[model samples]
Target: MRDALRRLSQGEAHPFDVSTGWDVVWEHARYPQKAVLGLAAGRLAERPLGPYDFKAGECRRILTRLGFAPVPKRSGGQESDDADDAAEADLRQRTGLGPTEKASLIRARRGQGIFRQNLERVEKRCRITGLRDRIHLRASHIKPWRSCSDHEKLDGNNGLLLSPHADHLLDRGFISFEDSGALLIADALDTRVLDQWRISQPRNASAFRAAQCKYLSYHREHIFLGRED
Candidate 1:
């Protein structure tokens, strides 16, 4: 599989098709097969595959092993951050923030400050779960921070207060919300995993603002899986 991947990287014609190669890699490769396929596909195609093809976790692992860093997948139809190290260096210099400060800013940007305050005003509890405790709730961005524009980044309507489990599922694209606030579960997600997480299909949807509806449309088109339409 590695040899096939290497040959594929070099633009050489290979006898094995992508699916056949994937099967061999999935069966025998020590590394995650999706990562191997993602790397090969990304290299050859010069573009990152969607989460449905190579999940965020697998892509991160693949890039890390190849001496590259990972950044958030963009939501506005932009490409992945190919120059991750340069982008990080530029961020550090531009912001004059140390590692700890940068980490703090990231957390704040994702779920604190005016964003969280506004979300709290509109939503008193988790949208999917009934958990109301502030300690257990997170202000998750509908359009992720790294993907958001400056205005969208702090837009109150673009956020949701969700319990940790729901937040995880949403962030990783295992689930998403329609513009009308219906829950969307990825087809690729295992039922066993959902059962283990004690998550059920949410029947009651949250109320969405006009702006939130726009952001949710983007999520459905770019982030959510299962629907090809």
Candidate 2:
């Protein structure tokens, strides 16, 4: 493997057909894996690094593009920190918030400040686990705060108190709730995770008020990935 990459990078001849793109008609409407490969098929998916055939070319290409070809100075240099810097800069322009105000507001978005206090008053425990401890729970927005208006961002009715694991599932669209409060599991989610996490996928533990249901409706319609059963 090492020799092949070295030879390839040095423009030396190699005996590896690692640059063939196979047309993989899989992964579907949910994940969109069509037009996947091929240097020049009936249709080519020009994805930057796929020229090296599907067998091994893609892997080699990714290793180099990710800047993992190996550096003399930094043995394992990390990826850039620019993502957060860019996101924060964008946030400042959108919200017109100075550094101090934006800092606390960002904290509130991650479950702190008045938003969390209001959520605590309405939701006493993690919905999925029934865990009453606040320390182990996170204040999760039903309609994500990132896409919300300021009014919705802070609305207690727009949030839920969820355990960290449950928050992850919901945030990533692995699960959601119907307006009637029934659990809606995503087709892509591994059912084994429910057992491992000890999640029961409860139904109607407590009724959501009309206002809360309003936001949950958006969750089911848009955020819920798709049905499993």
lDDT of 1: 0.59
Poorest 10 consecutive residues of model 2 by lDDT? 71-80
Model 1 segments beyond 4 Å from truth?
A: 1-89, 95-107
Error of 1 at 141 (Å): 0.8
- Which RMSD values do the candidates have, in order? 9.9, 12.2
Best by TM-score: 2
Clashes of 1: 0
Candidate 2 lDDT: 0.57
Summing lDDT over every window of 10 consecutive residues in candidate 1, give the lowest-scoring window: 17-26
lDDT of 1 at 85: 38
lDDT of 1 by residue, 1-229 (tens): 3553555445654322222011212222223234445556755877664336654445445554664433332231232223333444445576555776555444546488766776777677887877889888999888766566555656778788888888877766667876666777765567787788777775557667786888887665445543222
**What is residue 34's positional error in candidate 1, in angstroms?**
17
